[model samples]
Target: MDDSSPPEPTGDGHYERLSLPGSEFSPLDALVALVRERGLFVLVAGGVVLLGTAYALAAPSRYTATSTVVREAQSEPEGIPSTLPSIPGLNIDPGNAGRTGLAPSAYPNLLTSREVRLAVARDTFYFPETGRRTTFVKHVNQSPGAVELLIDYTVRLPWTLMEGLGRLFRDADRRLGASGARSPLLAPSEEEQRALDALEKKVSASTQGTGALGGESGLMVVSTTAADPTLAARLNASFIEHLRRRVREIRTQNTMEHLKFVRQRLAEAGRELERAEDSLAQFLERNRSVIAGGGAPTLSFRRDRLQRQVRFKEQLYGQLQKKLTQTRLRLQRQQPVITVAEQPTPPPEPSAPNRSLIIVLSVLLGGAAGAAAVYFRSVLASAEAQESGREKLEEIRGSLTAEEIVQGVREELGRT
Candidate 1:
């Protein structure tokens, strides 16, 4: 009959509930409970934080050096636009000018390409931890550092296992590849190509605008990272140098080959011109009397022919020499497909092992772990309390999802 008292159980159906005063829920009380039982949470959190600290300490520092490259950009040459057809109606095409287009967008790929990479490797020496006669490819893949070694092994373990499993599905593929089947889509690359693949992982490239008008606004950025700062800088520079050289070769290859041919002809012409001069001299000496008598038309004709031959040879040689000079200039001018805006310098400090960032992240991670543990324990405690209350206490009706809220309500009521 009284509102505060427990109702008697009905004999026909329902289970009887024990009356409980001040047994309710709220967030503040749940928080108090968590604080009271924070030991496990603290331990878990501390362990996580400790692990993060250890990882930070064990992680090796990495130095990053960047090389800024500016694309040469496109512009009309000094003379006529040879690329543009002289016909009455046709669009201009720079690629038709017999020079490879120096496109900025393609620089990233060219810089990291196997050809440029291998060329760089061939020219450069290995950087001894301090900073190589060996191929740059071999030099770049030197063994990992202690920390790096640990990480590589640890990280690669699962991948290694997965690779083995993957191979099971590709047995037929392996056989086909081994048999050298000519599939256009899936041809195998050379070992050097695979080496370039690895080298590419260490190198990165990007582009920016130079604020210039027209199609030449692209500024390329190429960067590389390594354990040693000097090595990073040197490798980046080497890659750029080789990339430039490669681009120049590609653009001027035809002209250079033609120039070589011209030079050979020029050499032959020089010999012919010398021989003609000597023969003409001998003929003039032998025909001295005939020339004075003005009766030797054949001798005169012979002398005239030799003089013409000498002049023709000299003219040919001059033209070839001029052509060779022009081609050399063209090659020199086209060599700056990608100019170094800024060379890589040995970084003063390591880029990785970011200590402050590690510390902050570690604390956040630890705090999250602690919070999760607290929440889990809080839920478990609530479940147990609910079970016990079901057995020995009366249920209160406030809200269907008000179990925790009721518990907090009880705590405040008891305190008052």
Candidate 2:
């Protein structure tokens, strides 16, 4: 046998041979032994199952509710402009309209804005059963006499030692150039920054998804979430209503203003036209005999001038009539140009607290923890066995050496 190689088993079962260096035990045998030795693995797995069951039972049940609002495009009028002259090779369709001012994607952010939040916050209750009220902050000032007493009791003072050190440092700073040095601090104005601080706590809004819903013509859905579902729904409805009102009001105001200017211009044109007709009539009356004497030049000139004046007045009047009709349509509240395809409904459930997902995660986590415990326990048991075997090997080596020493001394005595 080679000394470098490990000793092979003699089949008499004195010792077992290792396939590799330093491996005296089979993994399969170790596992079997571990299974026989440790009842803790079963206990740990049972504990894990128990904990998982407890978590599933103890956790709060979560419910989700969603409400959708479909944004619709503004309706267009049915007919082409009467003034647009028909010509060859010209293809004009009234249905080919420009995009509406409002967009579905834009509404989501507006639902969560401070403007919407403040509006909802001002209202006390959407429905009486919810029993929720809006809360506002109020600041009160202390009376002059109580101010000093309140300050003395409430204000924290510096330690005496620290105060003394601070005084020394302050005196040194005052004596040096530090006293007159400029500070680098810059701050926004109170009024300008006041709204910014309240923005986050005030409003919450989000968009749901992309594309139109249900293959509906010109319909886009937007959804908003809030602490209060009723308020969220109300705010969303209000935002859409507000947007429509604003668009209409703005358009109406602009159109009315333009119409007023146009009407004034028309009035001025009418007056000018009347005066031109009167002057032409007088000229014709004065030149009636001259034109009747076959002077075609004078007759043609007067007719042409009068025709031009009539045409101009007619065109101005026509434009004003068209503008007036449009303005009237815009001002009418009954006919909303941008109609709400779907009204906002109070959500039936909160759109959060996904319970099923949480329970699944808990089970997975418990299994992983149980597996880690089993591995750690096995490793610790193997380390302990290795330490115990090393100590026994040291003791055996010491005893064998002592016996050899005794035999060597006995042999020397016999030789003597």
Predicted model with the maximum lDDT:
1
TM-score of each: 0.59, 0.47
List model 2 lDDT by residue over 6-100, tens digit each: 44657784433222213554566445434543455556655776666665555433322233455444454445232333322223221221223
Error of 1 at 225 (Å): 0.7
Whole-model lDDT values for every prediction: 0.66, 0.50
Candidate 2: count the clashes: 0
On the 0 to 100 scale, the lDDT of residue 73 in model 1 is: 57
Residue 266 in model 1: lDDT: 64
Residue-by-residue lDDT tens digits, candidate 1, 1-416? 76344346588854232222245545665455456557766898888888888888877678889977777754534653333223211122323534455566787888887677666656555566534456665554566578655665685678656745655546556566576456522433343444555577778887775466225557777888777787788878888888887777777786676556656766877787788889888988998898889997887888888888878767766755655565566656633456677878999999888988897898899988887777666555444457664444334333434776876788889952
Question: What's model 1's TM-score?
Answer: 0.59
Segments in model 1 whose C-alpha atoms lie over 4 Å from true places: 1-25, 74-95, 121-124, 127-136, 139-150, 153-156, 159-194, 254-335, 385-416
